[model samples]
Target: MPIVNFAVAVEKGKAHLDAGRPDLAAFLFGQVLEAHPTHPDAVNGMVSVLMQMGRADEAMALLRRGLEANPNHPDMRVNRGALYLMTNDYESAIRTYEGLLAEEPDDPVQLVNLGGAYMGIGRIEDALDCFRRATEVAPDYGGGHLNLGMLRMVLDTEGSAAAAEADFRRALDCDPNLHGAWLNICTLRRRAGDPEGARDAAEMALILAPHLLDYHQNFAECLLALGRRGDARKVLESLLQVNASFLPAELALAQIAVDEDRPAAAIAHLHRGTELRPQDPLIWANLAALLHRQGRIEQADTALDRALTLDPGNAAARMHKGRIQLAGGRLADGLANLAAMYDLPEVAAQSPFGRLEGAEPAWDGGPLAADLPQGGHLVLAPEPDESLTFLMFRFVAAAREKVARITFLDFRGLGPLAGQVPGIDAVAAVGDGADIPCDAIQRLGALPGLLPGALADPGATVPYLTPPPAAAKAWKDRLSALAGIANLPTIGLLWCPEGRRDPGDERALPLQQAERLLQVPNVRFVSLQFGPAQNELDELAQGGLVTRLGQHVDSPSALAGALAAVDLVIAVDGPAADLAGAMGLRAWVLLPHMPEWRWAQKDGAPIWYPTVTAFRQARAGDWESAVAAAARSLERMLGD
Candidate 1:
């Protein structure tokens, strides 16, 4: 065998691979290996290039030949183990790594690979232990800390954020050029509601790895979170320049266009994505949604057909199809699809009891026995959001004629008020499922599909969740004392809702826009807001323009009572809006331009809530028109 400079040849091979010409890299590596058959660098480089080119069998043959020549070769051994991991042969990967560890103990890279194989097999505890050991043996190895940080987040997403972030930062401290550690820190910063910090970390990642598509995407996400739409778009566009077929960058750009209220631009991006990957169902599904929203029914239908054909279980496509059917008066079909939309992994993760996991089979709004051993018991599981749960109560109220007895397996902090709802016969906490009487169980979200006819019957569903009479009286008395003028029409109002809200959260309206409604004549406004939003009413309260229902606003029951006491409830789309709608109260539900499909209008009202009229922002972030319309409605309804 000829003696060649293996060092220079390996460097050239790597350079070729980095230049995106794996074939050239493979040829160079092949030349080096032919001259020096047992050279580990040549074997490893050639193997990597072959794998990149999807020539795994050829790569394996070359690896075996090299290993036979130099049986104890470290790089070749590690490459073989990594190939096993990549091929989903977790057991083989673990064995290979363990065998290697016997020869070279406490090797951080081998330990990290072993941890990955353990993770592939879902042995989370083992994976954690391996990752910890890798860091322990090689504290300066950034990869070990990076792996540990990622695993911690997966272990308990919200709970482990701080610790995971610390690990990521530690990794960056050990190796300043570790782009992956910086990327993880960016994710953690975003989760901690520090998008500025996230953006900074994302910038570090992008600077380190300008060629990495994932880092660019993360940087764009950080920008989006910070409400820098133009900057995010620039990042995503540049990513497309790097890799024209990058689906994630295309999706991100489309979402940014949606945020900017540029439906045409969003559609154009989705169309570009389709051209790049015609078989990708996600792009097709998204295209369908925008087309449907714009009333391009035929185009949307075509998109939906293409999406569903590509992936029959595509939830977004199915949900949009249902929306189209509902809009077209295909009631049952639409309801079923809407039902499917709720049955998503994200929704289930939001609530432990989002769906019934009872021993009894799920009831599909079927006729119940007049006398089950326990009197026709049926457990109603909850939806992810409180607003959705409130809507579920409407469905329960409508279906009261079918089931003899009801037990709501309430989650989502709605437990405090579940028993107070009109049709609920009993209420139980989520974990007390065993104690709850249930002959059969059903998900609250499933009600739409099960009882579409009943839900559609306004008479049956209306006023299904009335605020407690005594609670209402208490709120009314407080308002009467506070207002000084007993006969003035009282209005319950909300701008920002409780929980996570940002500038990009369209469901929340700016308080300044709502201040105009507070100045209406003849009507006294009651503040149905909590936390910092209540502070916005200080000036109005001082001027006697509004009455802040301070303590009552914090309690769910008291909030409902406030709604009952008011002559009208005008609010943004959230729990308050859903509560008013569920109670069949006269209310105005203000909507963003791209509201969820359930808020779609029918005869000037939300389709799900016949009594709640909607005032929609014609474009994103343009709530002024909607606010003005609500003010006029307020004047007509209660103003002098």
Candidate 2:
């Protein structure tokens, strides 16, 4: 009777160990062994606890003795197989499980466990077969169905959405409460473009286990894919409420906040997340990215360093650190870092020669003025940024002073009134100047309009060769005027850098804000906006606050004429501002919180453009203040 009581006590101890109460189970098993030193049940229970606690050597020692006493125990064989699996001795585990299976042909649990061991050894086909056999042995085993479905998902083609859906459906049929099956089904529906179906599957999973974090995360992903970002946020927020320390939900929230242009909120959540999971490499990398965008370059660098220290093979951390160095003006260090990590696309993009819009790299100081000596040959190269344009403009003006008497043909092509002034000696519109050297040819070019971290071939050139003077000027003038006056003191607003997918570009002012210039007494605001936002300018002009001037001009001369006529130009960090500086026009340039490579950090006047005044955004997403400051500067200029 006392031996039976000892067995009951051992059973309770094993149950505690199964439920993750190892400390309590060890204490209970100790009490049982102290009272009954020779009890087989007590010895077995203590061995199970040791195995669960990962003390494999201790567990094996006791199990060896127990198995010597009872050589035919199926449970002992199964336990030993599990221990082998834990140690990644897949061959041994497989042998043990197969022997047990031979003795008991219809053991569903062992079949599934054997499949897991096969998977560990990269024998995916064998694992799939084992799971399939498991289902054959136990047709109603939900876990086996789910395992088979997951394996099929990997083995299937990218277009096998239908097959994936079927497998997930069968898994659910086997066990209605299989949350993983529901999650996979929802993902399949999403890939198939059936949002409602995805939502239905997600809801079914949530209904079964509302507290399951993975189920909630899957539902949130479905909501995001369905264009219900707000709903997605709510689901993630609920998960956070349930478990504040949940890293997955916190990271998801941070990403959503960034997409919605709430970088501050993203930073806040990520800060807490990194603090909670200080050792998680991913958390540190994510935090670094958010910090970098928010203008916290130093903090971002520190975070990236921490991530690299924690995980030396973290490519993202290495890439981000290189970018931060580049942004911080550590050019050589950045370049070296970038070169080291160029295998990463992001690092490759940090190169100055990255893909640029309409990019044309100047010859490497080879054959200076080879194409220039031809009289009436107009080299129409629009400036890329205000700094470069300003320097080039001054250099050209100085070069003209130094090399007097050479027939240097000048053409104005970007910004307000660029072509109207007409002070250059031999300048003429294309096809209009007949007196010029017939042997002379024109070389017209456009700005590259590149952004930070974009990469291109060393000698990439623009698609369209620079047009003849009149034609190039016409297009440049028209585009510039359209950008500046598209709404009125033609504020040539450019809210983003070319080639950037970062959040700083997307949350810019709507074109309607350009119309706000009409509110200023006797002032006209113009649209200098470019890139994707240009598509909306025509619609914005219907309000009559701004006029679209870029419609007819494809040549630079067209834009030059428009640039020559505007009163004052205001712009964000873009090529248009550079065009204005090259034309020697007064402009107010709105800079990002941290200026780009050309702008530099000294805080005084920019060296390239003397007529340009730079205004930096005080904080991230504070474009409103930047705009307001521009309005005030305009008021003073117009004597308002």
Candidate 3:
């Protein structure tokens, strides 16, 4: 053989492989291998070139011939094992690695490859043991520590992150420029609710390995957690340009759109994500939820079915499916779907209520105290949203008969309205409720499912909640104070009155958009819209357009009285709708093209509210149609 520059040839071949020119890499490797067929490095170089070119069968053939000629060739055996793994022949791959480990038991490279083989077959414990042994054999090897750390995360599914963090730290100690370790640390910190730490780690990972798409995705999530939506959006948009079909980048963009109050944009992003990764169940589930919100019930159901078909165990898919079924009146199926969400580890960890002085039995809407010698004291879990708390008050009245006493947990400002609800006992502020000696607790959302036909009582849907006399007097006096307030029929408006509007608030009907309704003759439009949105009211009030009415009412009962003072309430879907429906106040509820599960599949026929009428949008984000319909409804009402 002419003295060949084999080192130069192999180096040049590797450079070609790195440049993604596998054809050129194969030509150079072949030239060297022809002269020295049995040379271990030459054969390995040719095999790598063949594998890179996606000719795995040719690579395996070369490995087989080399191993046959040199039965004790370690390099050929490792190459054969890698080929088996590439072909997804798990049994062959595992046997090959095991045979290699038998010869070189302390080789961290062989040990880690075996661990990966075990992982392919779902033997996670075996994989974890292999990774642990690899680290034990080579304490100073960064690759071993990195593999150990990553494997520990999978093994310790519910354990503390200390072990993984420690291993990752050791990996970094072995090599400070290990981008993989930094990426894992970012993910670990984000999961632990340390967004600040996650962001710092993510920035380092991105700086170290800007080529990796996951670093960008992780960075965006960290930014989102820190309420940096604009920054997150910019990062994700740029990431998409690098790889348009990047699934995680698309999902993160969809979430950013939702945060910015742009549901239409959110839905568009989610739809594109579904197209990019059709088999991804969560994307389909999210799309279903957004569709269900827009009143596209049939389409939402179709998307949900596809999601469930792909992944029956997907928690979000199940929850949204349940909500859709319940909205469609399929109570049993909906409840079954909800069971997973309610049983999630996070939800299960919450101690909703404390043990009362006496025996506290869980009230499942069943007749309590029938068997227990000690009577049942039912303590209902507080609603996170004040509207839900009030909505539950009416139905909870029926539960009073099942238990000796019923105590409503007042967490979200429901303390004031407790007196108005016809129930047995006091309104215990959340913490105090646990000490009241109650035997059992129940989630207010579960009452309908627990007691079949229990909510069918006509009286429950009627005007069950009453405004306090004092609250009603305050609202009436405030209305009387306005000049000519009593002259024309009053219509309460709950649209968002913000100067800089949020596009994501689907229920937000901008005050300016109500110009047509304002044109309705012989009607006094009072501002029932509240919160930061009042700034818009102040701007219009300066020129004698619309005065803020919410500034006058502070409590839920007071808001209820304010609603009662109006002849007809025209508002978007929100707390006002919940109160209006509960009070049986005649109101026109402007609905988004896709409303929430609370309103059910149809707009006009809300089961909980008999007097309220729904004005649904014909297209997504088109409040004009719903508002126009409301204006027409007003014209008709005035004519009547």
Q: What C-alpha root-mean-square deviation, in Å, does candidate 1 show against the real structure?
A: 6.8
Query: Model 3: which ten-residue window has the lowest total lDDT?
Result: 350-359
Estimate the TM-score of every prediction: 0.69, 0.67, 0.70
Better candidate by lDDT, 1 or 3: 1
- Write one digit per residue (lDDT tens) for candidate 1, span 1-640: 5437778878999998876577788878888878887688888888888887677788889889888987888888888987887678899999999998887789999999999999999999999999999999999998999999999988875668888988998898889988888888887888788889989999998898776678888888888888888988998898889788888898889988887779999999999989988998988998998887676788998999999999988887887888787666566777677666765677556754543475677887876776777678778877767777877776776566788888887554566577777668887765534556567888776776777565455434567776667778888788778735587777777877563345667788877677677677777777777767677766453335766665466666777888888888888888888888888899888888756655766666777787888888876667988998888887786533
lDDT scores of the candidates, listed in order: 0.79, 0.61, 0.76
Show model 1 residue runs off by greater than 4 Å. Answer: 1-50, 57-239, 248-270, 283-305, 315-329, 350-356, 364-367, 395-398, 409-424, 427-434, 459-461, 482-484, 497-503, 539-543, 636-640
Residue-level lDDT of model 2, residues 1-640, one tens digit each, is: 2323666677788877765577788887878767765456666777778986689988888777767877777677788888888788999999998898888877887888888888888999889888889889888888888877777777777755666677677878888878778888877777678999999889888887675677888889878888899999999998988878878788888889988889889998888888888999888988888788777878889999999899977877776776677555564455445434545566345322232212333322122243444532223332323333333332232222322222323323332223332222344333212244422221211111111222232111111112235654554555455533444344434444341234546334444554444455655554444445555755664446655444443434443344445677666666556556666666667776766544543336554455678876777656666667766766786794
Query: Where in model 3 is the C-alpha error above 4 Å?
Result: 1-11, 20-39, 46-279, 290-296, 335-360, 370-374, 455-460, 497-503, 541-545, 601-604
| Clashes within 3 Å, all models in order | 0, 58, 15
The lDDT of model 2 is 0.61
lDDT by residue (tens digit), candidate 3, 1-640: 5427888887898787765567788877787877778666668778877876578998988887777778887877888888888888878989999999888899998888898889889998898888888889888778788888888787776563778988899999988888889999988997888989999999999988786778888888889889999999999999999889888888888877776767778889999999998998888999998777656789888999999899998887888888887667665677568656755556444424322323355676777673555456777775445555556666677777777777777655666667677764767775544555666777666676676675554224567777778888888888888888767888887875221357566678766777877888787878777677766765552225455677765667778889988888887777788788888888878887877555663344676676778888898778899889988988998999
